[model samples]
Target: MANNNSTDKQGGIKNNNLNKTEEEDEKKKNKKIFIVIGVAVGVVIIIIILILLLFTFCRRGSAGETEATGVEMTEVMEGSEETETLEDTSGASGETSSETEESTEETTAEETTGEEETTETEETTADEEAIAPTITLATYMGPVYSSADGVCYYRVQANVTGTPAPTIVWSRNDGSGLGPNRAQVNLHSPSETYTLTATATNSAGSDTESITLSWGCNRPPTVHEITLMGDHIAGVDYTVSAYATDPDGDTLTYQWSASGGSIANPNINPK
Candidate 1:
């Protein structure tokens, strides 16, 4: 009986040791599973945060790029507008320069024409002045003279020096004018005074001169009779007598001329 009791006690102690080892193994497995679940939850949360940050950054970068593009387009439009304005200003400047040149040319032409006209007028005046005429001399030739039929004749002369020869004209105080060098008059009275005028004329001017003359008739003495103092023969000496008469009673003196003979005193009283 003592041997059987000691064998039963040893079997009980072995079974209790086996049960404690199994419980320790089960506790270790549960601890390990809790730790793995905690680690997985933390990894999932970190991935979600990274995705949200990436999306926000992309949206900000796109907005910055759009603003830069709009600024570049605005600068290009302003540049084009400035270029067009410059072209318009250049065109206006060209037109103004052309107009100025044309105006200057017209002014020069007018001045040249005016100078030509003035020169022509001056030349014409000079020509007219050069062609003017002048008179030199105007006078009478001599005194009046009487003719056989109680007619009178007078002469006048004139001379001129100029571009053209001058014409001479004679005028009498009897209201008669003629173009002759000599003038004729019939005197009804014994004596008459006459005034004669001569005029010298040309293209430029004229000159005049006058002369005075008188015409008259006077009777002359005539011898009536004569008597010789010597004989009619030659070389004979004798006294002589003479008788004389005159239509005009005036003092008388005698002179003798010999043709072919000689005498001592041909003008002695008759005996």
Candidate 2:
């Protein structure tokens, strides 16, 4: 009976030691989990702070650009105001000079005697018999080929008549007057057309006539091939080459365009 009691006591002590070890292991596992959770939370907080800082920096940059643009606009507005003020002052001065000239003319007319007025009336009545001006544009004989200094042009002429020999003026394509009765039009393409105008003015009246001229005398340029060199990447420049020939040996002008992005020089070849 005594031996049995001693064995039972030894077994009880072993069970207590096992239970203490299990509790210690559980505590260590819980501590490890807490450490992992804390690290994850700290990382998340740092990421949020970095994002906020980046956003703030971007906003500041945009605001700075806006301020700079506003400053430029203000400067332009001030310059325009100054220009307007100067123009107003100049216009006022011109009006004053014109008024003074008119006053002087009125005084001179008032000083004229009754006999001079009667003589002026007689001269005006004599001039009233003059006929009105007339303009006649010659039939377009197509574009006349003319080359001077390696430049091609189309020459045109017209006729005018008046009682007192009216002044004649010629204009082409709605541009400024070229001269008396002749005008020149620049040759743009084989299928292009030009409008030539003639105006005659006299004391009696004024007359105008217009004629259309189709240019098909010269051959147009032909484009053979267009090639691109280098990689097409954003923010990087690439070279574009075009092979073209003009049959008439005329000077060729190259114009380039793109659907997107920007070109350094659109008019230059190999852009």
Tens digits of per-residue lDDT for model 2 on 1-271?
A: 9999999999999999999999999999999999999999999999999999999999999999999999999999999999998888787998878888999998887778666988999988868877799888774334445444332356566677788878877675322374567666666655667777878898888999987766556656889998878887888888889999987689899988889888789899642
Clashing pairs in 1: 229-239, 229-240, 239-271, 240-270, 240-271, 241-270
List residue ranges in candidate 2 displaced over 4 A.
Answer: 1-124, 139-142, 145-152, 173-179, 220-271
C-alpha RMSD of each candidate structure in angstroms: 45.6, 34.1
lDDT of each: 0.63, 0.78
Clash list (residue pairs), candidate 2? none
Q: In candidate 1, where is summed lDDT lowest over 10 consecutive residues?
A: 136-145
